[model samples]
Structures are given as structure tokens and as C-alpha cells.
Target: MDDRIIASLETAVGATPDDAVLRVHLAELLLAAGRREEAVRHAATALAADPTSGPARAVLADALDEGAPAPQAPAEDAAGTGEGFDWSRAEQEVGDLAPPMYADGAQDPQGRAFDVEHGDVRLSDVGGLEKVKERLEASFLAPLRNPELRRLYGKSLRGGLLLYGPPGCGKTFLAKAVAGELGAAFLHVALADVLDMYVGSSERNVAELFRVARESGPCVLFLDELDALGQKRSLTRNSGMRTTVNQLLTELDGIGRDNEGVYVLAATNHPWDVDPALRRPGRLDRTLLVLPPDRPAREAILRTHLRGRPIEGIDLPALAKRTDGLSGADLAHLCESAAEVALMDSVRSGTPRMIGMPDFAAALEEVRPSIEPWLETARNVALFANNDGQYDELARYLRKRGRR
Candidate 1:
């Protein structure tokens, strides 16, 4: 089946050499077939011909994962005779496009310095979601900004916020941005680091984490994947797991008004799985639903991802319009796809060109937004488990979107 599609697309591209869209189509087909080299070649050709093509750029971005680009194809063009093409030159051109994807994130926090003064990320850097930003202002930021008023009204310096959403919708990014916004240090905690195989050790780890947060006042301690740390006790018959939840609850409330300058934030894809005790007032009580990136946010995310890469004629507004349901991570993936396509095309045609729109279109068609299943699950929970109106916001969103 793939052979037939490739044959047809190749013929179409051959008949109309200037039809960059056809080349993008061929690039998508080749990419799907795991022919990364061929895909990048077509994508590069498409971009070279029409540098403004979004699909071309999107494909170019995705093919190359940082530091691990696919090997270039043979010197000869597989589609036609290699004329006016320099294979080595084209390969080199692609090498300069995609920087290492993991260079910014995924660093081990244990080995890294996270001093508050070292953080450069600010809320302004976070694009779109004005509503989320507003919520943060009212519930989280207002007191910090207006401390005199907060003191007059009897508000505390510390608070707990639980960010809940589908996977890859920028929860962790938002957490860091919040820390940056507040000029606070960011402490990212993972369950694997806290969970111990020995009896009673996991509880101790939780205590130590809280202790570290208390000592590092004015810090944002972000607990990634909260569901793992505080899952419902009824569901887990394991005594160790229940103990961890109890310890977490104790830490959240603190023993002697101790959580004083530390702000606790937790993110979870499965909020319903979190123990009910954790959601009670004064714990991770405030839940903000981080939906898929809205249109404006999607545009910002795309722009951020493609900023340093070799890109041309990208209509970010138009691209964002086309990618209505994609998450922040999905937009990042689209950019990567664009780069990958350009790289492959550079090798095939022996001409490295800037990424274009055709590559983006091709990649967009292949990479689906990973939000549907999450929404489906959320819808069920909103309808059935939201007995106390806790998920009223989610229910309203589902109904507005006609998913309820």
C-alpha cells in the first residue's frame, strides 16, 4: 500500500518539478515508511522551491531528533539523475538546522544548580492562555504581588495549587514559568526519586522533600506526576503506598505552620486518581485545568520551537489556525518534523534549503494531537465522578465542546 502511494506521489512530483506540495506529500509517505533519508530529501527540495511552504518546514523539523540525525542517502538522487546537486553540501546544511532537543529540558535536577537568581524564564515568555494567567494572578500571584493588602486581609505567603491536565499540555512548563514569574527557585520532584524499595523509606523521602522546600523558602516545589505519590488509598492495598499518602498529607498541612514561604505545586494527568485527602482545602486544593493549547498559545509554542532553526515564510497564525486541537508538545513535534523533512531533502537533492510550509503541512497530517483519549477519560470522570462539583469546570468545557 505504501509502495503504491509512494509511486504515485513520486510520479506527480516528477511531472511537476515546481509543485512543492507534491514533494511534501512524497516526504510524508517516505517518512511513514521509515525512509528518513528520502523524506528529508523531498522536504528539502520542496522548501528550496517554495521557501514559504509550511508543510515543508514542519517535515524538516521532525525527521531529526537532536544529535541523532539519520545518515544521508547515497550521493545519487533516487528519484532522478543528480544534476547541480552537492550531496555533502546538502547534508552539512541540514546538520545546522536542529539543535539538541533535550539540551534545555530533561537535565537531572540533582546535578543542576537551580538558584532563584539563575532562572531566566518569565511569564511573559509563556504565550497565550490569558485565562490561565488571570487565574494564577487572582489565586496565586495576587497575594505575592500585593503583600501589604494580603497582610491587611490575613492572607499567607504560602499556598498550594494543583495543575491538572492531559499529558504534554505544558503543565510542567507552566510550573517552571510560574517559578520564573515569581523570581523563585524551581525544585522539580519526581516520584521515582522519592519512592524507596525499603519499608518506611518512601515516607522519609517525602519528609525530606518538604524539609528541603521549607529550608529553601520562597521556592516553587513542583511535584511532577502527583497521582503516583498520593493515589487513593482505597485503590492501593499496599501499606507502603498508603503510608506515603499520609506522610504527604502531613507535609502539605505542616506540623507547626511550617510551610511558610514555600509554594507547593503538583501536576497530574490523572487527577481523579489522586487521593481525596490531597484535594481537600489547604492541600492541593486549587485545581486548574490545563487544556490543549488554544490557538494563540499554539502559535506562540510554534514560534518558540522554530525560532533558532533555519526556517522561512512560516505563517504562524495560519499554522496555528490549522492546528486547532494540538497540545504544546504536539506543536513542538510539528516543528521537529519540519526540520527532519528539510534534512532528508537536503541529502536527496544535494541542496540544503530552509524549511517551508509544505513540510509543515505534510508533518501536520501525520502527527495527531494526543488529547482525544485524555478528553474522553476526562469526560467520563466529569460526568460520573464529579459528585461535588469539583469538576464543574471540566464538565462545562466538555459540554461547550459538545463532547459531554
Candidate 2:
């Protein structure tokens, strides 16, 4: 039977590549022969050739279920056997078999939907960054909820907010928390999403990004690793990267003060690397430095992360003091590493149980800070200080440390 199926596939491949029916038949044969992965490839090719091909789609779905834990009804159960179920032909015969049309009209599929998308994280879940949270709430959440306050201000809220600091400092997490606090839609737009090889496609993606945010009012557009998209063209030799930055700038500038209900929250490790135009007043006006957790903040972070874990008495204050330069994310990772050490110890002793202080200390030694290089670069950028009060606190911290 396997040989017969292989012969059929060879014949099908020899035939025109556009033969959707033959492709589906070959895929089905391959699936029955236990070549599930190859079956999926053939089925996908068939679907690409004729998107409306129901038999091909059914075969592809069946192929996906192979070796998967979940139980799925066989194609025979769904469409019946020995009938050569051609969905395209069936749709043509019975007009009602067409694809469902959405009432919302044509729009960018990736865009935020105000009534649909919501944040996954809450302020309570954040565990630390109390001061930062309070500041953000005052600036964004307060004005958003109280329409009276906004009216009193008279001017519509404008520009984006940038969260810049060391990696693992909870910039992205804070953005999510803000979204949840405001009860607004959260659309995280990464640099990869807007990148394209084709001309105009990159710009189109940027337009779509802002367009979706506008359509979905009361939305938070979170751009992560923003330096990738907003990088200064002077540093890059690639015209494509420069074009992408220009497109981003144009989209940002287009969203003026009048565009209320849509908020842009961007995060970057290297704020200085971003184009000056993007950092201008109407673009990213509010630049919040999300620094590494201070002594008190670090203690809170350690306690929060270690809670409910089977740990042999941890002196959190001592730990916090030791982890002076660590970010919230770094602390979390350190805790994870400690847990792994405990797991290894348990396995060695043939007993699985709680982690001890020694385990944590050992893990701390193994897992050093990941942001040292980035921090050094940031220090260099800070040398030619524009005297923006934004850097005062960070500058003070750096001056004492003496540049990494």
C-alpha cells in the first residue's frame, strides 16, 4: 500500500503543479501511509493552489492531528468517504457554501480592536515599581478615566510616552499594566512586524498600525524594542532601515493632539539611538527612565518573586543589597536559576523538595547581569547631556557608579 501511494505521489508531482485534486489525493495517501509531516506539506501546497479546496483543507487538518495529544474527528467522519469531496465545486453548486463575510469591513487584520483586545496583565500582578506605577497612573490613567479633568485641561492629550532603561527593567510589563488599568485594548507592535523587503510595504504596515489604533479607540499601541524601528539613520548604512524609520516618523507625526483615545507606549533599551525627529514634542514627548530596581525596590521584587516558592529562609534585605544593579527581570531570572539549582540538588539526592539559601547563592554567582554592555553604551550617550531634567536621577546614579 505504501509503495502504491509513493507511486501515486510521484505521478501527481509529474502532473501540473496546479492540479489541486491530485495534490489532495496524494496528501491523503501520504497521511494514511503514516508520513504525516509530508502529508501536511502536500495538503498545504494543494490549499495554496486552490484556497477554497475543502478536501485539501480537511486533509491538512487531519495531518496536523497526527502524534498530537488532542483527539480530532477523521475527515471521513466530517465529509464522508469515497465521495471525492471537492469543496470548491460544492461551493459553486450550492451558493451558500461560500466563506463567511465579516460585517466590520476590510481592515488590517493585525490592528487593535477596541471592543475586542484587552491587556493580559494587571497592576497588582506587576509586584514592584510602585513609584513608576504611581507616576504613570497620574499622567495617563487619571486623565483617561476622568473626562471632566481632560475637559478642564482644554488641550487634547498629544504625543507618545517612551520607557527607556536597562533590559529586564519591566518596561514592557509596565506598558501592559497601564493598558489593564485604563481598561483599553493593547496592541504590541514589534520591529519585525513592520519590516519588509518590498518597497512601500514597510510604510503601509506603519500606516496600518496607526490606522488600527485609531479605529480601535481607547487603545494602547505598545512598540517594543523601539530603537530597532526608530533608530537614527546616521548610524545605519541600510536604506531599508532608514526608510522604515522615516515611515514610522510620518505615522507618528500624523497622529496629532486631536487624536484622543489612542495612546502610544514605546519601550527601548537605547533611547539615545532613536532618531531625534521621533523624540520630538509631538512624537515621544514623555520619556520615562525605567531604571534598575533601587535597594527598597529590589527587596520588594525579591519578596514578590520568591513568594509561594519552597525556599529555606531568605534574607530579602540582604539579597536586595547584594543585587544592587539588577533589574526586576534580572531578579526574576535569578530566582528561576536558584530553583533550577534546587531541582538539580534534589535529583542528585533522590529527593524533590524546597530550595535552600546555598542553592540561591550559587545560582546568583552563575547568573550575572546581562545588561552591562548596553549600560556602558548608555553611559557614553549620557556624556553630552542636553541638561534635560529627565536624566538627573539617572545621571546621579551613574556618576556614583563611575560608568560600569
Candidate 3:
């Protein structure tokens, strides 16, 4: 066997790793050259790619004829499993040859389908929104904290709480804080995590999602976008989506399932778009409105985003006051814009300077409130669609802000 010919073939196999025929040819050449170990590796990879390739199988057997075992495979071919081919060990050895199949939601170390995150953010970490906190305490937290009082008063933990507000107002963060307050695991899911193209798959995902929450008792299953997931069934055209909604409803109702310790929290920017069935008595019945951060919260958010950045003469209170309608995300963008202005100035003038009020003023002119359109839609819902007074809280906020 010529070494140059073998090297060229090896390079060709490397370029097209999935080409089983090319790999078999290279393996045969390597085997003829008495490089049995390398031959075995290439043969195993070829077999993995095309399981039905008899040539690859023949070459693999021939390479391992005189006690030359597979690379990373055990000395005993059986691996003590009474099987001819130790596929599990072979997979362990050649796993890197092929990428893992399929990408899914958060997985644990043991490769469990769903990951239950231990909550680290307590309600105290959430700045401002004292009124929203008070509502949570009254409706959800206080009851859970006092089981005896809850039992005596017949306060069954049957329904989950819904958080509705403009986007970027920290609804998801608020739900995590609620989880932290309970010292439970947090399972944050979104629309993409559930819906599948195949029939019945979406429903199964919904079921599995609740199953994980139930197993991780005292867990907060925070559904990020409820409007899309639980869209009004009448309005939704796809039968798969409608069935998915039904599955979610069944899980929320705790039909034939224990939900005592599973806390469900859902958030939506357009609550009006959510299925009314989802808001029935024993579902996501309770609603909480999450508005833009108040002054204290604005100051805290600004300080948080600007903590590590070089700054001088940054009046946080004044900045917060000026950013009245901006959401937490908008505030973060403002900070980034301010930093960019300072960076550009340093780059142009060849002299570095700390970010000052002027940088923030420049950022302010660019980064306006992103939630105005959301507020306008909400105002329409509050005024025209408040037949059940579900959006009364929202209407009040709009009226107070003169958005009504």
C-alpha cells in the first residue's frame, strides 16, 4: 500500500465523514497496512452512519479478527451483556463521530426532558411595584405561607394567577420572584417549547410540562406567553392548536391529577387574546396587572444596568424621573446607548472620559418608551372590552395616566 494514496484517501474520508463507501475504502486500506486500530475506528464510524452497509461490517470484522478490539471499546466484546456487539460501549466510544440527534427544551444533568431550576430571585429582588407585590401577597403568597389558615378558611389553591401587562415590564421576572418567595423550583416555558407540527405531539408536550411541575412540588410553572399558547379557541383555526389549548386547560384544572403544590403563573401582553376558558374558576382565574416600573424601580433598574460601566455625575433619580413610561428593557437599552455615546466619543477624540449626564441626555432622545403601542391597545380593551370588568385595574391605570 502506498502511503501517499492512503493519506489522500484519509483526507477524502475526513472531508466527507458521512460517506460510508469512502470510509470503508479507507478502512480497508488501513487494515491492509496493518493499522488495525485506526481501521476499526473508521469502520465503526462508517457503520454508525450507514447501519445497513455490509462492506463496512465486513471490514470491521476483518480489522478486529486477531484480538484488535474497537477503539475505546471494552476488552470483552460482550461487555458482560450477553450481546454480540456492545452497542452501548461502541456508542460511548464513537459518540463524538456524530452529533446528538434533536434539540429540545432545558435538560438536566441526567438528560431529563425538562429542567426544574431552583429559584434564586426573591420578591425583595424585584424593585418597586409595591402594589403588585401587595396583590400577590394577598391573593397567592399569604395563603400558601399559612396552610392552616388557608385550610380553615377553605382557601383552596385551585386556580393559578395570570400576569398581564405591556411587554418588557418584567412579568417573567416577577413570576420568578414569586417562585423565589416560595423557595420552590422554577419551570419557565414559552410557546415554542410546546407547539409541535405533528398531531397529538403538542398536547403531549403540554401534558409533560404539567407532569414535571407536579413532580417538582412547590414549583412555579411560569408560562411566558399565554396569549399565543392559550389563544381563544374560537379564534384559532388550527385543530392542533385548539387541542393543545384543551390539554393546557385540562392540566390547569388538575383533572385526575394532584396540583396542591404546583403553582401556575402565566403572563401575556394581550390578555384579551387569551382563551376565556383558561380564565374560568379553576384555571388561570386570578389576574394581576404589571405596569411600567415606578420611580424607585426605575432608579433601581438604571443603577443595576449601569453598575459596572464607567460613569461620572450620573443623576439616577433625575434620569428615572425623565423615563416615566419606559419599561425595564427600555431602561437597559438606554444605558447601553449612553455607553455607546461615551465609547464613540473616546474613539473619535482619542481621549477617554466617564459617561456623564450629557451621554444619558443623548440616549434619552433616541430611546423612547417602547410600550406606547401596547398601552394604546390595552386602553381600547379596557374601555370597549371591559364587559366583565376583568380589565378594571388596567382601565384605572390608564385613566390615572390620562391614557384613557
Candidate 4:
């Protein structure tokens, strides 16, 4: 076959991709020219476009059989009924050619509807948030671990704890750590998990989330970005969002002890934006402030990020001292920037070099503390909206940092 003729047919097939007849013609020409792979692909595509096309089927079968050993012919009675066909191989060849007609809900492990996790990050693994750890132990872990103590003191695990602070400050990790301490399944829910485009679906999703969490008994249901999921009803203009918040409130206040063994932990960067009802007496009633990493935490964060990378003469203590107010995330970026500096320098000099203090100094010049803006916003909230003393800890921290 002339290559020009094959090219012309390919162009025609490309122009009218849905035309199974054109694709079959191209497949036949390609097959005749000994381009078996290209012939098989086109034939499979044609078969996918028109499953009943006899020419597409014949071409696909011929392309598939081109290099195979021949078997004795099938009995004449069974010839046209697919009895001698390798249907599985044919299906495999064309399986990915057709797009799916529909999509289902997202999948999870073990065929569950939600992505439940088992965390191994204990509180001890979390570095230098001693005050936060102490608060967790006293308010959350102690009560859960000592049921007798809880019963003796009449402390009910009926409400959730909200962790609020700047973004990228390890709130999620702290929630996971709490779950790890409880030795329970962790179901991390975000705003996207509950909201739906269809009416009433969002409410159903919220109810379903709680239902699954309840079924997974002794589970930690960690709601991330609570400000988005349960924003103040007064500020929420979308009726759908307000209803979703209402549904969440209903779930949190589960009927007749339906939420007995479920532990709720929520985190948000803007706790003030979270629905006030969510912080009522029996909901997420407790709040914890997570500030930027202190010196020791900064050192630990820098060490963790720099691990497994080539380094020399890096003074962690000095680096930690210099990065006083940087969040864990900021420290991570600083480490990354330092590595990039070393990498680019080595590339220019045509030699490898270890990441050192000089590279880190350059990174320091580029990656200033990211928590400053968050602290500024927090200062305003603490100074203005903290009439209830709900943010006293935040206020004290701000004052100590001279931001008040």
C-alpha cells in the first residue's frame, strides 16, 4: 500500500473520529502495510465506536492473530457464535478506547464510603508544643484514658475540641496524634466532603458522614477547616451552606447518645468565622490555640526537613534562634530553598556540594517568617472580639510577643 494513501485515510479518520467505517478502512490499510500495532489500535478504536461493525471486528481479530500460532478450525456449528473467539483478549484490546458513560462516588480503602485512616503519630512525636500537649493531656487524653476518673469526676466526653491558629501549623497532625493516643480510627472530613451541587445532597452527606463515624465505633472524626464547613449562619448568604451547618449541628448533637464513642476534633485558621452555634455548650465547646513554632519546635522542624539530605556545618540552634516565629511550614520551605540554592550552585560550577550554612543564609534572606501576617490578624481578633475571654490564651501569647 502507498504510504500517502494510508496517511490520507489516517487524516480522514482523525477528522471524523466517530466514523467507525473510516477507522476500519485505515486499520485494513495499516494491517496490509505490516504495521500490526497501529492496525490493532485503530481496529480496536473502530470496534469501540461501533460494536456491531463486522469489518471492525474482522480487522481487530486479524490484527490480533497476525503473529499467533493457528489452531485447528472450530466446529462448523460453532463458527459464528463466538465459541472459538478469544473474547477476553478482544475486550482487553479495546477496553480503554471508550470513555466511561458515568462516574460513581469516590472510592475508599476496603470498599468503605469514606477514607478512614489509622494514625501512628503519637503526641510524643510532636515536638516543642509543650503547652498544647499539656492541654491535650489534661482536657482530652486524660479523660478518655481513665474512664473511672471520668466517671468519678462526672466528666462527659460529649463535646468536641477545636484547634485554631494560623494555617500550616500542624493542627491536622495534632488531631491525628490525638486519634493515635486514643487508638481509634480517624475519619478526616473537610468542607468538600459534605457540600454537594444537588439540593439536599449536602445535608445527606453530613448525616452520612456521622453515620459512618458512628458505625466505626471509638472513631475520631476530625473536621478540618471548620470555618468553611460551619461558618456563622448570620454571615453565610448561601441557604445551602446554612442548612449544611444546621445538619452538622444535628449530627454533633446526635440523638440519644448516638455519638457516645465518637470523638470530634475540629481545626480552623479562622475560628471566629466558625458558626457560634458550633461552639455552644454541648458542641465544639473547647478551643485550643496553636501558634507559630517556638525555638525548640523550629529546630526540630528544620532537623526533620533536612534529614536524608547532604549537609555540612549547619548550626541548628543558630538557625532555630533566627527563625523564631516561623511556622513548621515556613521552616520546611526554608530547608527546601536552602537545598535548591545548593543544587543550583553545584549545577553552575559543574560539581556537587553539600548544603551548608552559606546556602541556609541565602534561604534565610528569601524565606522570611510566614506566620507574621497570621499573627497580625490574630492580634486584631484578640484585641477586638475577645470579650468572652475565649481567646485569652491567644491574647497572652500576643502580648508576650509584643503584638498586643
lDDT of 2 by residue, 109-138 (tens): 654432336756788776557778777877
Ranking by TM-score: 4, 3, 1, 2
Clash count, candidate 3: 0
Residue clash pairs of candidate 2: none
TM-score of 2: 0.69
Q: What residue pairs clash in candidate 4, if any at all?
A: none
Off by over 4 Å in 2: 1-116, 255-258, 385-390, 402-404
Please provide, for model 3 over 275-314, each residue's C-alpha lDDT reduced to its tens digit, 9 standing for 90 to 100: 9999998888999999999999999999999999999999
State TM-scores per candidate.
0.70, 0.69, 0.75, 0.77
Query: Per-residue lDDT for 211 in model 3?
Result: 89
Every candidate's lDDT? 0.85, 0.80, 0.91, 0.89
Q: How accurate is candidate 3 locally (lDDT)?
A: 0.91
Best by lDDT: 3
